[model samples]
Target: MKKIETFCPVRDILSQFGDKWSVLVLILLEDRQVLRFSELAKAIPDVSQKMLTVTLRSLESYHLVARKVYPEVPPRVEYSLTELGQSLLRPMHSLIDWALDHKDECLK
Candidate 1:
């Protein structure tokens, strides 16, 4: 893998996790085996069908998420995290904890 420049590393990382919906989706699917599209949509209220489709596609392209399609009367699809994606759980949880701890000051 190519090493990103010091000036660009933060930007690159942010680009990967900057989307609010993507972060929430990742967190929701972190430990869970898999979730259907409808289930994900329900779990994450207020997300539009278009946005969820786009986000899932982006995550799948980045290898952060896996999409599985099953053949049936109506096609069934599910999404789950890949190994690299699962690795993000720890850091994400840490960030959540930090934000909770600093909520008071952060809100100022």
Candidate 2:
């Protein structure tokens, strides 16, 4: 097997996934398979429409989320995790589990 480079810039990777909304969006979409923009907005109750748009665009740019457009009278769009994004499920779940396990102590 070929060695993958570990030298890719950490700052860039951090910037991509480090944001609160980005992680939340990724987590919400992980098990759902796909979601429309309005569904995402409802799922993440505190997120503003603008923030949702920005986060989705950023994820799309990173090739982490696939945005599909359906040709219809009103036009429909759906977001789903790409293969790369799905790979994040294990680590994201670990983080969520850790947070839940420590929430009371950590927040105190």
Best by lDDT: 2
Query: Which ranges of candidate 2 are over 4 A from the true structure?
Result: 1-8
At residue 43, candidate 1 shows an lDDT of: 92
Model 2: which ten-residue window has the lowest total lDDT? 1-10
lDDT of 1 by residue, 50-106 (tens): 999999988888788999999986999999999988887788889889989999999
TM-score of 1: 0.86
lDDT of 2: 0.90
Per-prediction TM-score: 0.86, 0.83
Q: Between which residue pairs do clashes occur in model 2?
A: none
* lDDT score for residue 12 of model 2: 77
Q: lDDT at 77 for candidate 2? A: 98
> Which digits, one per residue and each the tens of the lDDT, describe model 2 over residues 14-87?
68876999998898888688999999999999999999999999999988899999999799999999998998
| Candidate 1 weakest lDDT stretch, 10 residues | 1-10
Alpha-carbon RMSD, each predicted model = 3.4, 4.3
